[model samples]
Target chain A: MSDSPITSGMTGKTFRVGDFLLKEWEPGEEERIVAAFNRVFAKADPNFRPRSLDFWRWQYLDNPSGKLLIHAEAPDGSVAAHHGFINQRLLLEGRPSLCGQMVDSMVDPAYRRGLQRVSLSATLSNSFIGHTGGEGARLHAFYWGAPVPVAMRIGKALVQYEVVRTQLKLSCAPAEVRLQGASGISVEEPASFPEDTVEFFRKVAHCYKAIAVRDQPQLDWRFVRHPECRFSIATARLGGELRGYAVYSHGSFDGFEEGLVCDWLVHPDDGAAANALWAWLVEKARASSAERLTAVFPETVPDWIRFQEAGFRAAPTQYPFVARTCVRRFDPPWLRRNWYYTLGDTDLV
Target chain B: MHSRHPPPSRTLAIEIRPLQKGDEASLLEALNAHRGGCVQQGHALSSEELAWFLAHPSGTRTLLAWEEKEIVGHLSAARHTMWMKGRQVLFAELLGGFVAISHRARLGKRGLFARLCREFFSEQGIDGDFIYYGWPTREEWRLGRKLLAYETIRTQVALTLSVGNAAEGLPAEVELMERFDHQARWLWDRCAAKFGASAIRDEGFLNHRFVERPGYDYENFGVRDDDGVLRGYAVFRKGQWGEETKGLICDWLVPTDEPEVGRLLLRALEAHGRTQGVQQLFCLLPEWSPWFDSFQRAGFLATDAERMWIARTSARRFDVFWLRTQWFSTLADTLIV
Candidate 1:
């Protein structure tokens, strides 16, 4: 096999290796890609939960920042490998910017070793990175992913994926808790967020050096409209105004019923709202019969210490968060100290 | 060992040279002068200890940045053999990195510390022989990321537990050792596969780090089966931290999957710590290690005092992400002991 001509595709760079066409994903190809994704992942793991077209469209096309996808088409017209990203709007150092959240990287077992002995997934990544971010290209400043173990190795060796943090889960046994005296704070699970959520998030945005812009649209798209799991949200109101909110989901992992704190957003000074939301989550966890309640937040986040004080002990989890910086301004150390993230920022929730 | 005098025109006539036989006093003076500036405040090493620090049985080197006659900065690299990816790889630990207080004001963007690092890193890159790592304070870590291209492998977290009653219901026999014997080596060889990456904890490294090191004492305990085959080993030091007496587990090595062996070793340490009147016990571990979960299951809790673990590697195979997931280290791999 020999390298062939390079042509422009959707992201503006394409490759032809022997008979295989390394090209950009285009319209009307959703079913083909989703089938390939399910096939590849199922071959890799016996218990991989197959992804659906609804999930693919909701994650990639329906996102506010739009979709970016690449694939390698074998001679038989099957997708031998695929790489994709869903762009996210980020508040970087108080400036709005775009970043890509990589997802659904897959390679068929037969085409695992791609062109020139590099993995196909790596080839797709290289092509994707070449066309995005930096200078006058796409506006993405960086790309991040929570990849599986094998993909992580290939990415580290071939694609320069620097580890941002090994995500540590804070977990404790769920216990009953009673709300304290009249703090004028109320907690409830609302069917939908009010129109003022965007304003509230904007007011709280200054507290973070880097974070995802979690407005009403993003929340609705991520939770209420998600194709699979049902996520419950609890909002804390003071004087009948939204002060904070927390999102949670329940599942049984390894035979232990667990309640996951997917997102927690409250002003560092708003202890009352924070406590009310915490009590609500605890009661919810207990009512749902969850043995353990788990939450993940960077140690640099302001609420990390609060959760620790609230009896959440740092425990080990298998997820490793990694990022590739396409822009020079954001390096690992700076990101380590400044980036605020939660489980909601990832697709795992 | 190599000596380099930077281009006199570019740098301010600074000379970066190797440490010679009679340089201990000058180095100690410079280190102690800026004791609390950026470096850690351990008791200043005596001449003998300094000599030992510079002397690795395999290889060691120290580079000093000099402005005419005064040493302005110092850096040292000592060779370590690590078990990584099912094989032994040569690595170096960078230590005693400091810049003199007087020189800080004059160091522009291209300063003496940067000069020393350039000379050292260029030499290492050209040789491409070993990967180097260091434990930097948060401040130093920020500087290192910019100047030295250091990437973090993991943050060091100390797992602490109130010294309680000895562990019970262990199936393995525990034996206390004055020093690591051949069985320790045998055990390490058998169990090295369990870790994706770790400092080689064979008998020689164990003796050098725990038994024969100066100015500190550590108790070595081994776990054995009914046939007396050593399955694991742990090193403990009774020390003072804050206002309490603590038993610090400096080094631990056991197959992470073998809970019985780990429990037996921990029980021995707890019993020994209890006899020594230790109020609490502490062990520094990377969360990536399954043994970290084991310690947590044994009732250890994570504390807030996390230190940065950074590394610079020229090896193509050992990338930052791979090392972050695979590397297993303890306090013994650091200078804290």
Candidate 2:
């Protein structure tokens, strides 16, 4: 009944159960949370992939020490419910302030009746979900649903709110194409990428507010972090002015044709530039012997138009999923969806 | 309104207004007051996270409704850059929206949302090229797709894995780094060198961000060829947000592009979890990513994956031709097209 030292083998106790009492998630539980998260997302994701537990560790717990946590307990104190509140700051409508995100709420539904302790853990997570509701219980899992109504309400009230919108788009797949040699447009792959490509991207990123631009750090992290993408940069020039560019990458991934066009780019408006660049890309992609373009962002980028118009039809978009978080909200909003192609989870700038 | 389901006459007053830093305390307080009814969503506010939220740019400019200044309802519209058909477009997102318990049915929130939308579009020199939004429910998808000037709306799902299962016999060819020792650290640089410059390839980066970062274990494994040359590597770790430990196969690099190799990497993970005391594991892959095929083969039942939304921005409005043709050779020839 109290936050007292839980004794082992205790019965008739409503909530308390040994050291592993149900409590909201907090900063220190990052490891435990990551451990449980592996189980949580297995059923939800096909790849059940993780870029790095450290990335998540920093994102969910270490970074967002700002978030609150809660968990369920057992008689001898084993974590039955690793459930709780997650809070973080995010930009809203061009304004910066604390934006509550509802995330990481789970219950072993099969053991739903094991103990009211689970319910107690659900309430514990809500302790912070009511973040904006100051003096309220934490919200459980608002963006996503919760196991119980009580938990759901807690999660709901804490979130910034649900925006009823759909912005996800499907990318078209590549079609059979033949590249013809074009004149005047010197389209040659750079022998070596400009060292400043990352810097160039940093400056170029300010152009889109719809998506977050990749800072030098993020670029370095993704492209430098992994070697999955075979990235190369190309440019078109006239009158000594840079007219357009393409940063394409070819990579091999499982579950698809051997080689894939991981990335391709063409400006949204400049037809000639876009055309030249795309033709070059098609020719180049063909040269790579790529059966598919896996690294492509469907409609997320304006270049998608050139890709589709040239015959790339709908190939299922890669690694799709909903974004939910009340925990570990990143500062500065690095992972902007708008310019995802350039975002470069890999292949560098 | 078009599709009526249940709960005759929803009752909360849904107001939307610009949220300020000071609003965190009272907003959370009000939410706590309605703790029982508010259970369907969110974690309650805390002082520390509240301060952090206020400090982040995304948390700024959010609109909060006043139930007499009690912080009953809210709609946070976070703006960011995105790629739309290959050009930069400033996207105004409707994120983190919520209504107070008493403000439901009054259309307070919708009205406020509409007002924000109109004002945003109408602003003089608004400095944005496009707008888009992502939603959690069908009603949401329908609303944004129908009312807004967006071209496409896609499905989103989430996938989970339970580490409780025994995944034995995953080829143990890959070895997890014991610690970020000099040898291990040297491999990181060698692995990073393949990407070359323009990459944030640095020992400090890996050490700080992944290897030594708190809450993350550097269970980085690498497979060697006959010569013991590291040909493939996978950095798998447990990611935690709340309660469950999620076994995430975060990054994997292989010398072989074989399906068997991919399967083997997964097998290595399956084997890894068993020894690490992992009860279950799941990683959210990009929903449409074929990479998940391996996970499915490995028996991870995927579900609940959500859509990934993006907004892109560029200094100059994204001009597709400029973006594409600059790279596409025919684009130059097709100045005529």
Candidate 3:
């Protein structure tokens, strides 16, 4: 467990877990990792796709936030388990901080029994965040959405992980949507996130203890330039200054058409702007013949009140956002009150 | 307006019988007159709406007590089905049980309400194996417990959060759907096994309970992975629960196998709630619900008052602990809350 630099070409630190060896991913392990991922997940899901090296490279090597890839090697030199974290810049209490999102986690079925699964997971996580200096020292937290039950249990019991919030689904019938537009605001579906929109987000970022930096470039990369999924961006301006913006897409579910609001941001003080943006979206969805419109938000989010007034209902499905951090202290009530999240921040869509 | 026939005299003998097709007028009059009861306090239903209630999909049968042609007492038996263990069990919910204030004393000695309960239970038995349940007032609950061996399972409490100032949001990547899909059905299959007892949340049940519900409009939100596999789903509506203007989380399912899905979906709901301008977000979860931790983490505080989830099982045994943990009852499941 050395705090040594882990570069693509150089062999980094390694740990022994039972007879298996856990080490940082090297330069040429994409094929082995992909093969092991496909093999493990194919058993769980018959339709699981075999990811290509390009997709892997796009997600890992090309990510703006640096990637931390760890794999457990068996005696045969095949990958037994894989765990990775993609770096993200976050505003923690209005100050810039480094965080990571845990992703691409899997273990070979052969070595998943007893404590090996737990050991491999813990060893990899510890190696990434446990180092004392350099890049590891700069890491404040690692957050992820929707860990399977077993992972949640193990992380809570063994790793002191805490759940940040439970995601709740809410929906509204397009035919029943009613909203009073704000007189000062004008809304338009923009082709990209404008600079004013980014500035508006920055103005409101301090309202939450933690949030992703939603600048123009990040927004462009996330919603506009995403490889899969096409999102429609709507921006609301008051006197030509960006007050709020929303991202959504139209799709059908179970034979019923719907507009899914993927992401949204409104100034904490701009109730009128939020209303105008919502009214415009509902009207847009109705114009497109979507039977209903839906969005996902945390239950504690105050903005949900506006959606409810606009006729949205809470759905029964929910997801949990969990976090594990050594440097950040999340006071339960405060964390519950201030953390801002949206359907757009995760990889589920 | 011209006066109708005078009110029934005290000496008139009361006769109880199955409600006939022409009873809608009399039933509406009786319901409107009894404004003290919970059902009567809400907006009065029109004749068309009354007919819709009597013609509920699962089927509803009302038995009325008449005093020389004047309807004096009324009770309804609404049939339903619930998932117990892994099977659908026939169930019935009693609704609109009441007697005229002047006729109450005489009817008690004759056991009018008790007799109606007996007949309804017997009728359910003749139809199929059934569990008779209801949300009776405290007085009625006591009477039923003494007379029909009704058992109080667990009291369901309303959890509320003043979300007016909370600043949480939904994860942007998780997809929020407004309709049920194959992925939702898949998620239900993956998530349903953890519950000890619940309504069958399959596509048929969802379509009937939410999509096809009369009067109120409901929407379903489905969360899926990138591969289009369902992780969880929720049913919600915007309406008043008692006096509060609230967004109700009627029913939701995220697999205990994937608690993180529950977190993400719940957060998404909160964000939706903010945009809707509800005074509060309300959810009905049993104290022992596995999702209670998630709800609490999202800042939902439980109110001091609770509603009883009472039932009369065919086995004639009351296992309160099992009912507390196994029974997945929400406000949406009740005939009237």
Candidate 4:
């Protein structure tokens, strides 16, 4: 395995289990990886939307915070199993720590059963965790992800995945909504996030116990610079200072045309900014002709209650939020009570 | 994606059988000796409470694992009638399962505990409606899912509000009742009509759960309409859990369309709870319940309870997805409060 720490002179070792070769992903293999991902996921889920090569490169190869990709190769040199992690900056108690969000885990159907007793998926996951997870790993401090149901089961039994919370889908009818005007707040659809957005997030970061870094650079990479999908960025300002912002997009979720709140951040005490951004979102959804508007916010987020008050009905979804700590252990109760996340934190949007 | 393998063929010298007459005292002694002999590690049921725990209105059955003449493990399944999709169905609530600490280590996958669960579900399965449900602690939740084939429905949280100094005015139409009367049935009928699934909270269940419990005291409040008929009701218990002295809303029922009645009941409970030296009130109702929004409108916020609802079922209609989306439950439906 290459690109990982050497233990007992194992670096650059060509590890082989029977006919399958386990190794770290190399450059110039984006096309094969993307094709394998599309083929494997489509076989697993009929409704799975295939990813383009450009989308794959932007997501895993070109991420600003670096990438963690490991794969198992079949005898014929096709990618059999691949596990990728996207490095992220997480603010915990106002201290920035590097974290990884697991994404794009797939195994080729033909090689699902490996030569040895261990499965290809398990071999890839074990290698990924051994190299990237635990206390001494320099790659990231911890990892978290929203896994599908089958993966959730296997991860819990094998890789120490603890469920933080099940994601809730809050939906509201967009039509016939009356928008109230905020007295002094102004909302604008900016082409890109302003540089001051980083400072704005820093000013309000201490208000939350745990949150992803939602500064300008991260937001720009996640929403504005994505290869596919377009998001509307609405920034609310009071007297020309950034008070809050909301990013939303219209899409089909479960075959229903709905509006999605990908990311929302407002100062905890600034009700005016929140109200203004919410009004802007309602108008945006109405103009786009979306029948329903939806948002995914953990109960710990302050806006969860506000969304309910704004007539969004919360219901449990199949998606689950799971976390694994490498350097330190976080109590599930404490994490559930304080961790703030939105759909943008996930790869869903 | 491994295939399911059969349990180990090796067997210990343990016999699984149902509890016969005159076995209550021995079961109680064994459970009390180990402290929380039940699988959940809750308070051991007393002699009288044991009878009440096993005496469900629908029916009750207990299976015990025996090594020689000694009871090494036990599991109880109690039948409960609930309204599911507007029709009555009987489901089993698996409870009071505990294994002797000395025997647990030897039980393994083919041990006495696993054998007891297999027999319990086999005897009381989804055939006639034996859908099973239980509120399990973290340890039991893990083991139940692994061995007993339990699926999580949803993790429930508690809605809490601080009882402040400002006194709330109770509606004149509301009255605190000594016991639930026949009008309570009408109130439950109206409330049940609007729910996807709920326990049968008729007059008998109301009295059995709140008024007639042996060791606990609960205050029942009822609200009336202009016609002097009962329109809503709420059961509150001023209890201390750990260090917090709080008011617990054990059960509540009001028609979904009648928000005023719900608000009035909340005001009456808050005023009453404050007088009893409670600084906060806690209610455990599903977010899907219409009354949950009513509680939120009255200033209650959802907080973590560190508990989850899990069930083992052969019935397809009561799958995890449907339960998570449509089921409406309360603290009264569980043994938590």
Between prediction 1 and prediction 4, the one with superior DockQ is 1
The TM-score obtained by model 4 is 0.76
**Clash pairs for candidate 4:** B107-B111
Better of 1 and 3 by lDDT: 1
Window of ten residues with lowest summed lDDT in model 3 chain B: B35-44
lDDT tens string, model 4, B18-59? 788888888888777656543233466688776766665666
Per-residue lDDT tens digits for candidate 2, residues B147-183, read 3333222233233456555547557665666433334
- Please provide TM-scores, in order, for all candidate models, with all chains considered together: 0.69, 0.34, 0.51, 0.76
Against the native complex, each candidate's DockQ, computed on alpha carbons, is: 0.22, 0.05, 0.02, 0.21
Winner by DockQ between candidate 2 and candidate 1: 1
Using TM-score as the measure, which candidate wins?
A: 4
Task: Give the true-structure RMSD of model 3.
Answer: 20.3
lDDT per residue for candidate 4 within A1-349, as digits (tens), equals 1122122111243467778788776778778888899999988889999988888887876665556777888889899988777766667766655567888778887886775677677766676565565433234556788887777767765566666676667677775333455779999999999888988988888878777777766788899999888999999999999999999899865345789888899987787888798888888888898887888887766687777666676655677777777655553444666778888888878
For residues B1-337, what per-residue lDDT tens digits would candidate 1 score against the true structure? 5558643453456788988878778887877766621124357666556655665554666788888888888887777777778666667777748787766653445767777778877766424436788877666665666568777666555788887765443233776778787787787777667668877777777787777766778888888777878888888999754445689898888877688888888888888888888878888777767787778667777764446677888875676557776777787776555
Interface RMSD of 2: 13.3
Tens-place lDDT per residue, model 3, B62-165, is 77878876777777766666666767666667664777777665445255666665665676552463676776654465455555665545434466766565
Which model scores highest in DockQ? Answer: 1
**Runs of candidate 3 exceeding 4 Å displacement:** A1-12, A16-19, A113-118, A132-137, A148-161, A251-257, A287-289, A331-333, B1-337
Badly placed stretches (over 4 Å) of model 1 are A1-24, A72-80, A108-123, A134-138, A176-182, A252-257, B1-49, B55-75, B79-92, B96-132, B137-152, B158-283, B288-307, B310-328
Chain B TM-score for each model?
A: 0.85, 0.48, 0.80, 0.89
